[model samples]
Target: MDITHRGPALPLAMMLALAACSEPLDFDLRGRMGGSVDTSQAALAAVADRPKPDDRGIISYPNYQVAVARRGDTLATLAGRVGLPAGEVARYNGIQTDDGLRAGEIIALPRRVSEPSPATGAAATGPIRPAASVDITTLASGAIDRAPATPATRTTTGTTAPAAQTGVEPVRHKVARGETAYTIARLYNVSPRSLADWNSLDKDFTLREGQFLLIPVVETAPANAVAVTTAPGTGSPTPQPPSASAPLPKDEPSPAAMAAAATEQKKEPVADIGQSQPAKSSAAMAMPVGGSIIREYSKGKNDGIDISAAAGTAVKAAAGGTVAAITENTDGVQIVVIRHPDDLLSIYTHVDGLKVKKGDAVSRGQTIGGVRAGSPSFLHFEVRKGFDSVDPMKYLQ
Candidate 1:
C-alpha cells in the first residue's frame, strides 16, 4: 500500500491529540464552577462580618421622670400613684395656688435621696424609711357630764334641757425625726394654727424629735346656744308665763336624729355652725370653672360669688354631697342644692340642665349641671349655714 493510503490513521492520531486538550478544558470548567461556589460563601461571610447598631435611645437621668395626668386625676390621686405625698408633690411642682390639673397636663416628680440623720450622725445609706402613718379621727367628744341647774324662772317652752358641753379630747402623736409642725398638722388633718394653739407654741416653732403634741379634734355641731340667765332682781325674769312641761316622749328623736330627719326634708337648708370649725382649704376645692367672676361676695345683696361662663357650660358639685334640691325660682334661674357631710350644703344656680337627680351621691368636683341659655350664664355659688348664705370664697381655692 502507498503512504498516501494511511490518512485514516493520521485522522485517528489527530483525534487523540484533541482528546488530550479537552481534559485541560474540563479542569478549567471545574475550577470556574468551584470559583462560583466560593463566591456564595464569600458573600455569606461578608454579611456575617458586618456590625450591628445599638437600639437603646438616650439614657434618662436619675431622679427625673415625667408624669401624664389623665382626666379626673387630682393632685392627691397623682401623688398617691407615684408614691409621694400630695403636699410634697404640690411643693415640688411649684403649685402654690391652684390644684386644678387640666387633662393631659404633664407634671414633674422630682426624686430625692434621703440624707443622714443629724442626731445619729450616721453616713447617708440604706433604703429610706417611709413616712409615719397618720390616722384621722373625728375629734368630737360624746361624753355627757353633769349640767349645773339653771335658774328656773328663765326657761323657754320649746327649749329642751341643755346637755353638758363635752370637752374636746386631744389626739396624741409621736414626732418623727424629720417631722415639723406643718407636716404633723397636715398629716393629722388639723391646721397649723390649730396645732400650735393646741400645743401652745409659736407658729414658727420647730417640733423636736420624739416630742409629744396634742392635736385638737374637728367637730361639727348645730347652732351653739349658750343660756344667758338674768339676775334675780333684774327685769322680772322677762315676764314669767306658766307653760305646761310635757314629759319626755319615749319615742322622741335625739338631736342628731332630728337633724338627719330635717336633712331628709326637701324644703329646709341644713345648718352647720360652730366657731372652732376649720374652713376647708382652697387646695381641697379644686373645681374647674372656665369663667370670669361676674360678681364677688358682698356683705349686702349678693352674699356669694358669681362665675360667668357660656350657657351650657358644666357646673360641678363644689364638694361631695347628695342632690338636695332642683328647682326654678321666679327669677327663672334654675338651682340645684347638694347636701354634704357634716350638714354642709352647696347651692348652684342659673343651671340649664341638672345631671344628678335628687338623693344622688355626687363626689367632689362632679358635674351636676350646665348654665341656662339666655340667662347670665353665671353660677351663683353659695355655702349655706342653714338658711343663711355664707361666703363661698371663704372655703374655695
Candidate 2:
C-alpha cells in the first residue's frame, strides 16, 4: 500500500514532538534553599500593630455608640439595652438574619438621644429616654432593674409617646463602631437623608465611634385634630426628652409594603410595546431583552422593572460592566449583577440560562443570559446607585 502525502498534520506532529523532546532550563537550588524574608528595620525595632479599639463598657463616637461585646451578651440583648431595635443593631454591625453576634467585638447602638430642635424646643417628638450607653454584660446578667426595654415592653413615662408632641429636653448620643446612617435612621424611625441634613452631614452620612450627634426627632399628629391647651400662664410644660423606647409608627408603611402597593397598581396594565423605548436608540443603554414591561419599579416594593417576553430570548447587558455575581434564589430564579462605572450596578433576574459568568467583562449589548421559561416569560431588571436602588427608566435607553 502506498502512503499518500497529506496537508499539515504530519509537519505539525513532527514539530510538537521535537518541541517536547527539548529539555527546560534549570538552575542550581543548593545556594537558595534556606532563603528567608528579611526584617531588619533598626535591628531592634518592633513590628507595627493596629491601634486597639476601646473594649470598655461603652465607647462613643460620631452619630453612633459602641460597646465591647462581653460574655452572655447576644445582639438581641445588647440592642434592647440601648433601647434600639435588635435587627437594626445587628445590621449596622454587618450581621444578617438571626445569627448570634460576636463576643469581644465592638457593637454599634442607635442614636436614641438627640438635641432638641430649635423651633420645637422639645426633642423632636416625645421625650426620648437617656441614650443607650449601658453595659450589655450587666444588662444581660438577668437583673430585672438592669434589663433593657424590649419592643413589646417599651414604655414612656411622664411625657408619653403619642402620635404628636413638642419641644423637649435635648438628648445626646455617642457614636458606636460599625454603625451607618441607614441603620441609625431605621432605629429612630427617621429617613437617612433627613438625619444627614439635620446634622449638616453630607449625603454619605458617615459615622464613627465616640463622636457625639444631635438626634433630630419628628412628631406625628392626626392632621384633623387640633391641640387644645391652656394659656402659658397656667404652668410650665413638662421636661422630657423624646421617647427613646417608642417602636415603629403604625401609620408608617414599610418599604416593602409601599413597593408592593406600587407593583399591584402597575399590574393592572402593561406598558405598550410600541411605546416601549428602544435602549439602543434612547440613551447610552441597551435593552436586556425585547419585551413589554410587565411590572415597573416602585420605591420600597420592587427594586427592578419586570419585562416579559418569549421563552429562551437572549438577555443582554444594558451597559458595559464587569460581572459581579451570578446567583440563584430559593425560587430557582437566576440573577446576574453587573458593576458599572460611577458606582452603578445593573441586575438581571429570573433568567433561564446564562452566557457569562461572574467577573466577566461584557460590552454594552453583550448577551448575558436568556429569559427563563414561564407562562409569560419574564425577567427583572434593576439599576442601583451604590447600594440604593434607582429607577431603571433613568438609565434604560
Candidate 3:
C-alpha cells in the first residue's frame, strides 16, 4: 500500500460539529477512547430532555456537554480524552481524583475551560443565561467564556426544585442511615450544591438516615479506554556494542489516538491529501538506501514503515534536522532520533555504526547510520508529532 496516496480522510470541520451536538448521541462521544457508547435513544431520552440551543444557537452549559456518569469515570480519564490537565479539573470542579463516581449520574466532558457552575459551585440553582455563541466555523476558535452562572435560592420543596429552571432531571437516591450531605454528594459524585438544589434542601439542613434524596446530574459516562496499537517489535542485529548501551524499546502510535488527536488538536499530517495524485516530494526525497518495503504502515497494525535492505546498507537522513539523540536500545541497536521542523521527529531504529552524535546538525540525505550485520537488515522509520506517531510516507518525500 503506497500510503503517500492515502491521506487523512477525516475532515476537521465534521468532527467539530459532532462534538457540539446538543442531544445524546447514539455514538460514543469519545469514539477513539475504545468502547461502546450508551447510544440507545430510549436511554438518552430518559437521561434528560436537554434544552434545545437557544436563540444564540448555543447548547446548554456552553462549555460542556453532559453524559451519565458511569463506574470508573474520573477526572483523570476525562482529561485523557482531550489532554486536560487533571489538577485544574479537580480543583476547579471540586472533584477528588480518587473518588468513585456513581453510575448513572450526570458528568461533563472536557469543557474548553473549567469553571464552577450552580450544579457544582456554591451558587444556588436557577436558569443561567446562555453562553456566547460558539462559532466553530473558525478553526482558530477562542476559549469559551466559562464564567459561573448567577446563584439562585434553593427550592424549599421537591415540587419545583431550584435546578428545575435549568431543565435538569433528578434521580432518586434514598439517603441511608447516618448519611450526611457531604457523604451523599460523594456517593453520587456530585457537588453538594447540585444535591441541595435537586431536593431544595437548606444549606444547613440535617438529613435523617434512610431519608430519600434527589440528586442532580447531567448525563455522562466513564471515559473509555484509549486504544493504542503498536506493531510487534522485531529484533535488530544482535550482540551488544562496546560503546553503546542496550536498545531502548519504542512504542508505535495507535490509529485511534492519532485520528482522535488529529480531530481534537489539528495535528493531522500536512501532506498531499489526494489519494490519486502522486507525491510531489517523493521524487525530491532520498531513499534510506533503496530497498523494498517489507512491512507497510497500517493504521491499526504497524507503527511505521519498515524497509528491508542488505546488512550494512547506509541509512540516510530522510530530511534535514538536528540530531536529537543517538541512543542504544536493550537489543543493542543504535537508534538515531532527529528533531525536525513542524513539531515532528524522525526516528531511525535498528541501525549500527552511527555517524552522527547527539546534538549534531545533519543535512538532508546525510548518512546518519548504517544497518547492523548478522540481523534482519531492515530500517524501522517513524515520524512523530509530540507524543503521537504518524506515517512516514506523509513526509518522507
Candidate 4:
C-alpha cells in the first residue's frame, strides 16, 4: 500500500502510537501560525495596579514606574524580566548593562510601557487562541448571547454608588544604606515581625538598600518615631525637646559631682612641698576635635558642623555614653552614633580606625577613632535629641 495515499490515516495512527508510549509527546499539529502572537498585553498585565507594585517587582505609580531587582539580578537580566530593552533600562537607572543589582535596588523605567491594571494576582500567559486563526469577536459575541444575565438594580436617582474605602494605607519607607529591619522597626516603634510581614521579608528579615517597605498601621504614633524632619546634611534650626534619660544607679556619682571633682581646688593649707595638687579633670562633654569650624550648622543646609582637622587627629567622644550604632552611608564613610544622657545622641562621621565597637561604654573625651584622610580632612559632627537633629555647637562646650 502506498503511504502517500493515506496521509490522514497515517497521522491518526501516529497520534495513537505516541499516546500509547510511556511519555506522550506534546506536539501541536496546527503547524506554525503565519502571524506573531502579540505580547504587549502580557507586559501591561504584569503591572496593572497603581501605587502598589506587582509581584514582578514593577512599581506602577501615577507619575512614573520602577522595578525592584531580585537576588543576583543584573540590569540586563532585570530588563529581560520586565520586558524592556536592556540598554534602556540600564541608561534609565544610570548603571551598566552588567552591573550586579542589590537584591532590592530600584531600577527606574525610562518610559511607561503599560498602564496600571486594577486587577490583581497572576497575569494571563497569552491570548487563549492565536489571533491569526480565530475570529475572537464572533466567538465572544456568540458566547455572550448564550449566557443568561437578566438582573438589574437602580438607585433613587438611577446611578451606581461608589465603593467604600478598604484597609488603611501604610506609610512607605525606603530602606537606606546601613538600615536593618530591626532598626527600622525600632525607628517606627513597630514589632520586627509586623514589619517583616508587611514587607514580605524573608525568614532572616533581611532588608536591601533602596527597597520600599510599608510601615504597619498602628492605633497610635510611635514613641520614638523618626520624623521626615530634614534630609541628612540639612540642619533643622528648631531642636526637638529633649527627653530625660534613665536615672543613674544610686551608687554612682552624678554628672555634676564628677565634674566638680575633676577640677583641682587650692587647699586651704598648702600641702607639703613634695605633695602635688589633684590632677585637673574636665566636664561631662567636650569637643570631639580641636579645629576651625569650616562649616556651621544651617537649617536646610548643613546638618552638622564641619571641623577642619588634620588627618589622623584623634576623634574623641563628646560625652560619657554607649555606642548606639556603627554604620556607613552610601558613600561608605563610617559613622559612629553614641547615646548619651538626657536622650542625647552624638554622630561622628568621616572617621576611620575605630577603636570601639557598638554597645561599648565610652567616657568623656575618650579616643574612638581618627579623622579620615581627604582633600580637606574634617570631622562632621552632629547632635540629635531623640530623632531630631540639633546644633552640635550647643552641646560641644
Candidate 5:
C-alpha cells in the first residue's frame, strides 16, 4: 500500500510524539507572549552613578560628608561655593588650594558641613543610595531587587533610610526556614506575584533562609474618604485608622436609614465607606449567595467572609455597580470585582461560569456567576473601601 498520499497523518503523528515526550520544551514555539524580553538590566547598565549634591554641593553620609566639584571649578572655587576656606578644604583632602579639580570628584570636608534633610534628598554615592538601596541579606543568598528603586528619607545619622515618599514604604521581612513566598504574601495581605516582583524572586518563587524580602506597600484610602454622610448636627466625624482590634459596632444604623437620610438631602455622597459609620448609613449590600457563614472576617487571617454553598449555586451581586475587573487567582479561581458608588468595591471570589464580563453594569441581587464546584464549596465575599478591606458583614444589610 502506498503511504505517500497520507502526508497529513505524518505531521499529526509528529505532533503527538512531541506532546508525549517526557521532557517539555523550554522555549516558546509561538511568539505572541509578552514580558518574555526584559530590557531592565541593559537600561540600568547604561546609567552611571553620579553624586547628588545639595545646593551647596554637599553629599552627606552617616560617618562623613563630602563636597562635589562642578565643571570649570578649581579647588579654591569649590571651597568658596561651600562657604569653607580654600586651605581648610584642600588640606583635608591632601590637595593644594591651586590644584585642578575634576567635576563630579568628591572632596572630603574637615568638619561636618551640613545635616541631611528632606530638602537635600539622599546621597548619590554611598553604601545606601537613597535611590537604589534595598533590604538584602548576605551575598551567598540571592539579593532582592526592588524595581524602580524607591527614594529614601534622611535619618538622624545623615544616612538615608526607607520612608513613605509617594506611597508607603515596603516593610522589610526576614525569611524563615521552610516558609514559601506564597505564605509570606498571604500573611501580609498582598499578592504572591507582587511579593515576587518587589523582591525579584526566582522563576520558581524560591526563597532561602536568612534572605531579606521587602513586603509590597499597600496604599489605602485617605481619612477624608470615611465621612460619606453628614448627620444633621454632628460635624464631620473623626476618622480613625482601621484596626482589627476595633470591631464594627453591632448597633450601627442600617443601610436603609442612611439611604433615607441621603434621599431627604437630595444628594448621596460618593461611596467611600472605610469606617463602619459610613457603612451604617450607605445603601446596604445584599448577600451575594444564599449560604451559611462558614468563616468570619479575621483581619490579616481572612480579608473577607466565606459563605458555604453548594457547587454551581448561583452567585448574585451584592450591590449595584460597574464590573471593574474579572481575574483569576494563582489557583485559577475566578475573582469578580465591582466598583459601586462613592468608591466602594464588592469582591466575589471562587466564582465560576461568569455571565457578566468586566465593565458590565450589574444591579443589586443580579446573578453574575455560580459557585465553583469543589470540596467544601463556598463563596468568598469582600467589601473594600478604596484598597482597604473592611468587614463584609457590616455592609450586608
Candidate 6:
C-alpha cells in the first residue's frame, strides 16, 4: 500500500528536474545550429569564388605590311624607310639567315596589339593592336624625297642675308681632256648654272683642258623656298661672304715663316664614311651552331658587337634581301650589306670571305660568307634604319 502511494510524487519530482535543465540545453542547441549554418554559408561562398570570363575579343598588334622588294634595296635602307630596325624586321619574320628576303616577295612585320574593347570587358596583354589590313598596294619603293620647304624670309635692317647658291663641295675628279661643264654637272646632280656660278665664269666661259674647277657645296633649301638662279658672268656663285668686320690676321709672315707655314699645312677633315651594306637576305641560308649570339649591337666606336667564333665558321646573312655591297676595307676585313624589300638594310663586317655578290637575291639565314683563318672569327653585325645606324639589340630576338 505504501509503494503505490509514492508514484504520484515521483512524477512531480521528475518534471521539476527537466524544467531546471531546459534553459542551458536550449542555448547549447542554438550554438550547434549556428555552427552548421556557418558551414553551409562557407560552402556557398566557395561555389561563387571562380573568376569570370573576359568579354574582350582577340586584339591585334602593330605590324608592318610586307612590300614587294625592289631592285637595289637593302635591309638597312628598307628598315630606315619603314622606321624599323633591320634586325628587328628579320627577327619578327623568323628570318634566321639574310636570304629570306627577296625582291618582289612579301614578309610579316612585328605587329603591335590593338586597343581592348570596353564592351567586351577584355584587355590586351601584349603589343598595341595593328590594322587588320595594311595597304601594301601603295608600298614605298624608293628613298623619301626632300621635305617640303618653308616660306622665305625678307631681310630687315641689321639682319644678314642668306648665302648665295653654290655647287656641291669639290670632290676629287681626274681632269679629263674632253670633260665639259654640262657633262660634269649632270653627273654630279648640279645645275650647269650653279657650276658656272661656282667657277665665277662668264656665260660663254669654256672649260680649259687640265684645269680643275672647285665644286661649290650645294645647300639644301626648304621645300617652299624658290631656287635662286645664278647671275650671268658671275664666277661659280660665291657663297655668302664672311662679314667684313670679322677678326683680321695679326701680320703676314716672312718668306722663311711662309716656308714653315707650308710645312705646317692643316690636314683636310676626314669625310663621313657611309656604313657598309649587309649580306643579302638570301645569303642567310645556314644556321650557326648552338645559336649563341657572337656579336651584339653597340653605339660606341665598335658600332656593332663581335660574336666570338672559330675561324672558317659558317657565316649567315642576318636578314632577307638582295646582296648589295661586298668589299674588303683597308684593314683587309670583308663586309657585306643586304637590302630588303621593306627598305631596311643589314650590315655584316669583319668577315673573312664573301660568298655572294651585289644584286644577288637572298633570304633570311642564308650564308653569304665564312670567317677567314687568322682573323678574329667574329660577326660584326649591325642594323641600319635606311642609311642611319641604330642599336641592333632594339630589334634582335
- Say which candidate scores most in lDDT: 5
lDDT of each: 0.46, 0.51, 0.47, 0.57, 0.58, 0.42
What is the TM-score of each predicted model, taking all chains together?
0.30, 0.34, 0.33, 0.36, 0.34, 0.32
TM-score of 6: 0.32
Per-residue lDDT of model 6, residues 1-397, tens digit only = 3434778776576557646852211112221233322111111221111112122222222222232333455555545544566787666544442443334333333542233333434332222211110111101110100000112334567563332211112342333776766556545555445555544444454554543444433434333444568778775754432211112223222345333322322222112123233322222222321135644444433344455667767676554465555665434656666655433556666566576776565545556777655443455566555434566655553
Candidate 5, run of 10 with poorest lDDT: 135-144
Ordered by TM-score, highest first, the candidates read: 4, 5, 2, 3, 6, 1
lDDT for 15 in candidate 6 is: 57
- Residue-level lDDT for 29 in candidate 4: 26
Instruction: For model 1, give the 10-residue run with minimal summed lDDT.
Output: 135-144
Candidate 3 vs 6: which has more lDDT? 3
All-Cα superposition RMSD per candidate: 36.1, 30.3, 25.6, 26.9, 25.6, 39.0
Cα shift from native, residue 155, model 3 (Å): 61
Q: 1-397, model 2: which lDDT tens digit per residue?
A: 1123666786577557646842221122221234332211111222121112232334333334454455677777766654568887766656643555444444555554332232333222223222321212111111111111121232356452221121222235456786665555545545445455444453345555654444554544224443568688897665332323333224333455444433432332222233333333546456788879877777544567778788888787787666666776435667777766655667777677687876565666667778888766677787766545678888875
Candidate 1 root-mean-square deviation in Å: 36.1
Off by over 4 Å in 2: 1-282
1-397 in candidate 4: lDDT tens per residue?
Answer: 4556867888788779768954224242221233342221221221111233455666554345567778999989988877899997776555689988767555667776554332422232111121111122221222211111221234469874221111223456767888876667656656555666555566667666756676665543434444667788898766432321122223333555434323311112122233333223444357888799877786434556788899998888776776766776444577777767665667788889998886666666667899988778888887766545577777765
Q: Could you give me the TM-score of model 1 versus the true structure? A: 0.30
After TM-score superposition, the amount by which residue 240's alpha carbon in candidate 4 deviates from its true location, in angstroms, is 13
- Candidate 2 residue-wise lDDT at 132: 21
How far off is residue 391 in model 2, in Å?
1.5
Which is better, 3 or 4, measured by lDDT? 4
Candidate 5 residue-wise lDDT, 281-376, digit = tens: 354777888899877776544567888899988887787766666777435677777767664767787789998876566666667899998678
Per-residue lDDT value at 37 in model 3: 27
- Answer with 1 or 4, whichever has the higher lDDT: 4
